[model samples]
Target chain A: MLTEERHQLIRDQLAADGKVLAGELASRFGVSEDTVRRDLRELAKAGQLRRVYGGAVASAPFAAATLSQRSRHAVEEKTRLARAAVGLLSAGQSLFIDGGTTNEAIARAIPRDMELTIATNSLGVASALVDRPLVELIMLGGRYVPNLGTCVGADTLAAVAQFGADLFFLGSCGLDVARGVTAFDSAEAEVKRAMVKNSAGIAIAVTNDKLATAAPYRVAGADAIRHLVVERTAPAATLADFQSQGAQVHFA
Target chain B: MLTEERHQLIRDQLAADGKVLAGELASRFGVSEDTVRRDLRELAKAGQLRRVYGGAVASAPFAAATLSQRSRHAVEEKTRLARAAVGLLSAGQSLFIDGGTTNEAIARAIPRDMELTIATNSLGVASALVDRPLVELIMLGGRYVPNLGTCVGADTLAAVAQFGADLFFLGSCGLDVARGVTAFDSAEAEVKRAMVKNSAGIAIAVTNDKLATAAPYRVAGADAIRHLVVERTAPAATLADFQSQGAQVHFA
Candidate 1:
């Protein structure tokens, strides 16, 4: 069979059986195990599947965001916002962080020697903080969302609600002046709302472009947010308008 | 058409399209949207597929251990080991925790007010520590292993070796007088061994039933372990045997 044919067949098998063993695929395709592995590698690079030891599994349902894709959307804005957000942290304070590429950056930007308690839903954030000796990491438990590399659901929300964090670092799919913070998933939005409500202060991390966008699910309104942290060059007048309305704007 | 036939058709559509939209499936299967949603829910419950907001997607290949299934095994024994393990801890002490079911129990058992630095490979451990006011949690990064909910790779091993932790909390798939500490995955074993080599002291947490079993991969020998922390009712003679082999055996 042709290589593309083999790849297609492998994907079909993965969908049908939920996993594919290298030896089994090799024998079935009449190819060397090395060839099967190569095929799996190529498919993985294409974001079609995930290769595991001696086998391959179906990729997570939501497409895994590439590093470049994550870095591009509002890069400088996220960095400035991260700096401003980290400034709120004090020694011995507790925090709850939601999952977002921007939040991962915030985890990295946190000082290594500050005595702080951090509760988060992002695996990326948890992994980033693994070596910071002064930060206490608390990962909330719930159903694992493979695509996002985090946990979510009613259980996760309930767990977050039980702890009153001094500050909450939040991310959103879109933020409308009137509709509030919105996300693509309703369940995740509920979790975000729960986090916002449970924290003493709320910091919305966003780029200038995301300030007026709208998604399917509403988490909260702009008025509910305590801080609007944005990049230095973000529309100052637009930010001022938000500050005038209610939010305390921080231009980092 | 029969319910089984309808189910099979929906499964086939999901396999072909990667997702089955509720409206599309409803029309194709000559069923109502509610009926399709119900079918998707049932499939999700069976672990045959995942139900999303508007449709269903294929489930990931690996079977995740249920929370209750994990909670039951080694409950009492792990609690005993946790108490003994915490005794080794002090304010400002840094530690490395290996990934396993029992180590997760140890993470949960940590005192809420103890000030310490904790590095771990287990997601369960990190999540359990999220809310504690005094614990600093670091999660080591590597290739994420879904079944284990931890990262393991050469990078993870190298990162672990860079730190000299005050204590290392270790777990094993099996432990034997002849083989010492064993793990199911070779990659996990490599990381565990690296952790043991980088720590000031090593404590092995195991239940009595795993006393003499050997697994596919070896982590270390009994001589390298500083403390063998086990439950109170574990055979005293077995503890003596380990102590005779140069391990500091402690029963809690």
Candidate 2:
């Protein structure tokens, strides 16, 4: 088959299945895995799809939406993920939580009776916890980005360095096996990197829309995440990929 | 009149007139200003009235309410003061805003088109400014106090030191001529004092209830405040006292 024909077939398969495996594609087309990988590389370069560990997945359609716009999207799915993420917590654990609408949902879902020490750079996250008496909240200060509803820049980075928490709820823009964790903003990516480095373990609660996706800035490898909360409707093969990376997967 | 009768009359005057000038009281009672000062001191110690520059005024009774509760009280009065406070701003100026429902109202009242740099320790304040594109917000990081709805402790004090802004909108628990600016929380008081020291000028917006009241920790003297925004219903004597101390008084 011509290389363009193979690329077209891969795109159709990815569109239909949300992801495509290199080995399966290679065997099905009677071609080499290297050839399939090359096709994925070209597709990803063209922004057609995202490359994963052994395949590529469709990019999220609304990744460029503002924070408020994103908060209103997938409310039920994010809430399910939030409830599952809250289940992973104990009564008195200190947490390093990054800023995102999903994380804001998690903040709201935290039980009022639970005693927690949560440190965050997100105003939305902190505001959700303001009325919870048992929670000791720490806000990281910096230049506030209205679009993200979070504080970023040097002051935030310095503030985040003070605490090494037991768990970190990462704000993910995209998650892929091959490319690891990713984000849309460079400064936000830096903050997430610092958070991953400072925390004892990292937990990420994402909707299925973020699975097998890739963004511009890389945060860390998928192997670095210790816990992941996603929808039960996520692709089984994608769940297996994360499981292979040694992450404890929870289905919401 | 006997000493006890004179004291009762002074208390009555403070109640009826909202304040009692020591010199005026002495002249009315055919006594020296020293005698009137002694009477004022005794009343202040008893918490019956607050001592100001030249007299005593009625103490604000609802000083111990929680932040959320306070936000709900005097909605119209606060909005009026907030509007007046916003009028003080010019485009491109930087402001250090302290935490309070009044300051939050000021945050909300800031024009969307105005270009400004605002640094705050209040989650409510930052949340209010999150949607404004022209404002660059800086949050002071520290331990969050739900009761006050702001960050406090050592880290917040340290974060506040990094900037010297054009003006500061002080969060006042009590504003007095003699006792000066005061707050109910010691840590919050420290944060406010740091904000005052780091800014070029200090402004405060208060409802009629806060005038001449005194809380536990001293923030600064009324003389330190360069701008004062208050309800038009505030006593003329109190307004004159602040103006006499060099504060540019604006009545809402």
Candidate 3:
């Protein structure tokens, strides 16, 4: 059989069984375990599967990657942006923090001594602030979308409407000068839009990669961003565009 | 200074400042870094402090140790009891799962294919069920207590009242035939009491060590427990007492 045949069969097996053991594959295909391992490694590198101890499991669906997977990308950049974004907040202000790894980082970077009232639809954000004594946390109730680690649906939107926050830390999937802020999922975008509408001010911290990009659902207009935080590596022209819209741009 | 005196000073410093650096302590006390390390190790062994890389932090307050700290105790026993308790559950039933390490274990052990509606106030339990496709999760919102990994206050109690569940997985701090199921914190106990009231059946899964013991706040009476899951090593008399209260007992 061709090498492609083996790889194709492996992918099919993983899709059907959720995982595939290298030894079992080797025995079934009359190939060496080393060949199976090589195939698994290649598949993992291509993002087709996740290799484990002696096998591989199917990769998370790309459209809604798990929170843990999303957290693993651009970690240091996210932390830098998060720290810069959290610094923009004043003490004693009530805020709505959205879901995303960057937002989760901002939740952690919040000063221990600062007092705040934080309402969130993000499980990770709530978990991060639970230890701090000065922060009063209110979690919004709804259907939990595990991959995004945020609540959604009509219940979540209704809960988000009840609170008019001083600020909203928007979780950005894609941001564009012309297209405004957007999210990958429609339900998430709707919830974000509610947050944008309910808060007096809005802030978003994004890595350079997200700039000038647009996801499917538009969350708000560029002018809606009161405070925009980006890494120093972001294009100067892009920064100027945001600044022209009256956003106070800060670089991490 | 004598070793005991150094240990005392270390405790004082930790209490005053919340943390103590080994190098700073050694220099201040005219001792070697190794001596400070030894002191920190001893204190950590005694549960008086938590040792970090270069220093020691004050131990969590005993009255409200963090949930992470509590989860470290009796891990294997809890897993066993959790598995046994989860076995008593059926598909298509709605459950109210409370907060505690054992209850968190039960949440993790829930069958992925079973369709269930779960309402919980536990950060840990919600986190565990988020990835499961068949579980419809509802997070009860309130003031998040970091130590307990649970929400409390009036909001939590009010939220609990809205749900009528087929089963309540009680997070047991202590259980006794005379005192019934109890919790270390009064607020947590109140939430547990509310869960007990809203559910048709109550289940308590406990390690043998928790049997016949009592905490400060009473959650419910012995007869309230519809299902009791205990380790096989529990005292026969105690098991009989639970059985006599019309509770169906299962052993892990």
Candidate 4:
């Protein structure tokens, strides 16, 4: 069969089966395993599939966002929020940061000199923080959420509630006057609520565009957050309105 | 600090700063950039740090049990359990297996030709099955639990609930006459419960040693399982007792 045909067949198989293995594909197509591997690699590079250790998995079905694609959205705002969030952290503090693109950026911005005990639900954040000597990472074991790249459940919620962190960096799906901070998934919302309740301070890291949006799950009301860190300036009237509702608004 | 002390200081600095840019560390230590890179390489080899794209960061912390160490515990029993579990599977049958050493073996035992839909919470199982073509694999995403080598959470539970599988291959931390199947972690217990509820048949894979013991978190009762696949032949009387309770017991 032509190489294009083989690749198309593989894609079809994955769409039908959710995953495709190398050896099975090799024999089915009457090609060597090496050829199949190469095909998978090319398909992965082209954003057609995700190449795992020995095969390929359909890209996350819910989000439909690649790692790079998710990374690009609101990059500047995430960076600014990360910078501001990092400023609140001091040496010898224990912190919990929810998993999201913004929190991942904050994890990267953490200075190496700062000593911290971090408990996180986000695999991306945990993996990023792994290389830091001064940071003692406690990964809360729970159900893995592929789309969010984190873990959440009753056990994760219970684990987070037991620790009182000095700071909690939270990411939201949407922030609005009515919903306050909301998440796309209910499990994630539960985790965020637990983090806020367990931490000494709650800071919401949001990009400018998320300011007026509302998702399905409401994590907490505007009155619950201690700080709102955003990129650039929010409307002065809106900032005052939030401040009046007991939020300390900070423009990065 | 003296020059020798300065080298130590730089090492300390690297520990404090996850990564040290050659120019930045050199400027801070009054050493050449080449010297900083060499220092990083040395630390990397010592397993104290990792070299990144442009600099160095601390290495990922080593867990107590290496992958190979943990793989040794239930080898014989897992092999037997895996074989028995595979016997229950046929073409186009969807299966859910929880993460454990036994399930890892079952993942390896799956025949490549019997078209199957396998869903799992274990990264090891997913990676092992990656070479099998006829087996459709779906990974249940949650927080990566290092000890269990899988993800767990509400999302993980939700993901598992999305499909009704023909069979479930489960690994238990302990099993008792009364408490039934238990797990070391509560979050895992929750995920296992969902797995059991969604599958048509449940097979408990236990090493001889884990039989009759009970862990902290109870996943299900002995009566809930359809089969008990173990490494060794249990006492005939014990087998009879279990059989009376509605479990079809098999010696691996």
Candidate 5:
């Protein structure tokens, strides 16, 4: 196979299986493992996949905004959105919190006496909830992807699927009425999808600028999210766009 | 079975069942409950197993073993032991680090350039590793018990069993030849036991006072551990006892 053709097949295998073993690919193409490994390395450098011990995982979301990156993007807007998101919770609720700056802020703003059970895949979120004795914390196990944070690999996805929660506090890289809810990382997207699948309701806390943007991996449609939380700075038209998609939009 | 072997089997029973009755253990060993109680007492003194009414609940060396507590106990000694423990590690190794003051110190003392895969149950240890860019951190998931400061329950135990590491750094409340490797909490004991089961080798970092004292939970026997790391202040005879039990003692 041509090198480019082989690369395409490798990417296709990754997209389908979420992973590609170099040894298995080598036999299929009748090529040396070294050649296959080199292909994986190139793909990794090009932001196409992540190389693991014996294989490669699909690349993380290419969106430049990391959790810490998003933290400094829009300060007041995120805080307002976070406080608004916290208001949605009752005295007792079990929530699956995704990893993101807005979500970390929301975790920090959690009321002390809420008597809540929070299950999070984010190491930062878990750290934030440490001193809050009243809250029961469940840390989800998974492969830790540096910078992007903890990912819901197979173990995490299975754990999330087997459990049910009262609500899901969804965080997103992009949320457009037309494109729906999207994330940068595929494993993260898969985890969010599972959280939505297992929870009774889904509430997304989004910044104003992220409203009309789109990321590579789609988690769900904007309409599938029961509640859309946005800062008051969000334009009226953008809020209308989300509300028209059947979401109950809340402006902080 | 030898007396030490009997102690080990009883400890295993404690691990698998989460508790062991003195009467039942007595009958199982063809001894009276009084003899069983003596065995339990010895194990309890070594912090191998906690003594409770009737039989024993898991040992929860509750009084002085919190991560913060240990940090204050032996500053210089723990630091020296931690540095030596890091020296035992090669650049590309993976490790399962249990939760303890000394263990957290060791995690912090980890060289920044040693590319490692660290799986840990301690929130403090995970937090220490956060800014480290090269290390791949895997936070073990489970129900977070507040005071213990780590995840421990069925989930953590199951997760430990499913994973393997290059090395296991077993932390304990006490380490003595007579009592073996011991911890304060039963689940911690069980998790440490699993770490030993999953890793290629086991190395323990202990302080001077922890040398002769024993906690309630027994994690392993002296022969089972390949390396015993200690502070220079540890007494010569105590070090000899561990050496006699088949551990290579390193005084940092």
Candidate 6:
């Protein structure tokens, strides 16, 4: 068969079978395995399929903005805050992580050697630790909202109530001395409230954009939060205001 | 040297060091590199090993829950059935998904644009669909089982019975005509029983391994399942046995 024909056939098989193994394809098509591997290599380069150890599998398009979208916003600032957050955690400690880009960064920043039991409502946070053999993850169940990838509703609150966490890393859409920490979505706000109530300590991670802005749904008052992590660009006046409200402000 | 002799030696070399170099093999066999390459090529063609840049490596280094190891077990066939399973879902439809490798593939196979309400007891499933804004996820809560990464016990079964799903994708540890559907763990089997009872349509996703193997605990009778998805490698007699039991058999 022609090389082009072989390529077309591989694509067809991949679409039908979810993968094409080099060995199976080689004997069936009367070609060298090298040739088959070469075809898989070319197909992988064309973004038709993802190459595995012995084969190539059909893949979902990179349409869902999971990593790039989260990492793109406030890359340097989030990294700094994540480093600071990890400093607070020890080898054997349990914590609660609410869903958001900032919280996702903190989960990623966790040291590999640390053995912690992390209870989370965020799908993103759970996935980040799946392969980490030492880290035990307890996922809170609830009515899931897709874009934010968080579990909320009554069930999520009930799940949160079950866990008595040492610390809570809360992500907020808006953080202010007057309005406290806020969220744009009501369901997410509800989950955040549970995270704050169930944990012994609350730390809010926010960028400078959220400093003065107040979102519609209020998660907690300023006094509920113990630590405020902000970017260096945050206004000095706002920092003083948060500190005055009994929040220990930490600049990333 | 004989072809079978060369094959056996190659297998031994691979078992010891995990790889076989083309140049070293040619010199050891006192044959041209082309001859050695041809032998390696045939081994690759037989699925005994995977051809690499300078040599061949052991076909599957399966040990962990990493993505590559998960994809090695009849991935093409599983993916094919997973694609078919997602076709049964529609917008606003609620479904129950149990935890297992086949069920994980089904979760990954969901179209990015399809808007469906997904209720799952699988951490893998929840994570796969987390970034999808259109699909809503409801995670079932229970005692977390690390190896399975699933929720089970009274809480999980209670969670299962609460939802009247349009469909339920049940993952089976074993399947047969006489023994029916079975799971290795008693907790998983209990949860599967609830899923089968609660959903309108029951579909069991199985690779070829589970076709005739019956485990200790029974999840459901063969008559209870509406659809049985199996790989093409599934024996014709086994397929007929399942069909005779009133299930609509689908070969991926």
Candidate 2, residues B32-77: lDDT per residue as tens digits?
A: 9998998777555333456789887643221223221444447557
Per-prediction TM-score of chain B?
0.70, 0.72, 0.72, 0.71, 0.71, 0.73
Q: Tens digit of lDDT per residue, candidate 3, span B64-102?
A: 332234444466677678789989988999999998767
Best of the two (4, 5) by TM-score: 5
Q: Sorted on TM-score, highest at the top, how do the candidates line up?
A: 3, 6, 2, 5, 4, 1
The ten-residue window of minimal lDDT in model 1 chain B covers B60-69
Single out the weakest 10-residue window by summed lDDT for candidate 3 chain A. A62-71
Docking class of 5: incorrect
Tens digit of lDDT per residue, candidate 6, span B1-252?
998899999999999976788899989999888988898889888878866657776664211232332323456667787987776678888888988767877888888898888899887777666667788778887656766768787767766766788888988888888888888898888888888888898888787777889999998888888888777777999888778878888767
- Candidate 6 chain A TM is 0.73
lDDT head-to-head 2 vs 4, winner? 2
Q: After best superposition, candidate 6 residue B170: deviation in angstroms?
A: 0.8
Q: With candidate 6 superimposed using the best TM-score fit, by how many Å does residue A26's alpha carbon deviate from the native?
A: 25
| Poorest 10 consecutive residues by lDDT, candidate 2 chain B | B59-68
- Computed on alpha carbons, the lDDT of every model, listed in order, comes to 0.71, 0.82, 0.81, 0.71, 0.76, 0.76
Q: Write down the TM-score of model 5's second chain.
A: 0.71
State the lDDT at B219 in candidate 6: 88
lDDT of the structure predicted as candidate 2: 0.82
CAPRI band for model 6? acceptable
Q: Which candidate comes out best when scored by TM-score? A: 3
Ranking, DockQ, top scorer first? 6, 2, 3, 5, 4, 1
| Per-residue accuracy of model 4 over A1-252 as CA lDDT, tens digit each | 545446657865654344689999999999999999988876653334678877887543211332335444455566677888788778999888888877877887799688888888775576455446677666664555556777677657766766789888888899887678899998899999898888888888787678888999988888877888877667666667667778888777
Q: Score the docking of each candidate (DockQ).
A: 0.03, 0.23, 0.20, 0.06, 0.16, 0.27
Error of 3 at B141 (Å): 1.9
- Model 4 chain A: which ten-residue window has the lowest total lDDT? A59-68
In model 6, the runs with Cα more than 4 Å from the true position are A1-73, B1-66, B70-73, B87-92, B112-115, B131-134, B153-155
Candidate 6 lDDT tens digits, A1-252: 545446657865653344678999999999999999987886553334578888876543221332235344565577688777777777877899988767776887787688998988876666555545677778788887766667788887877888878889988888877898889998889888888888889888788887888999999998888888877777999889888888888777
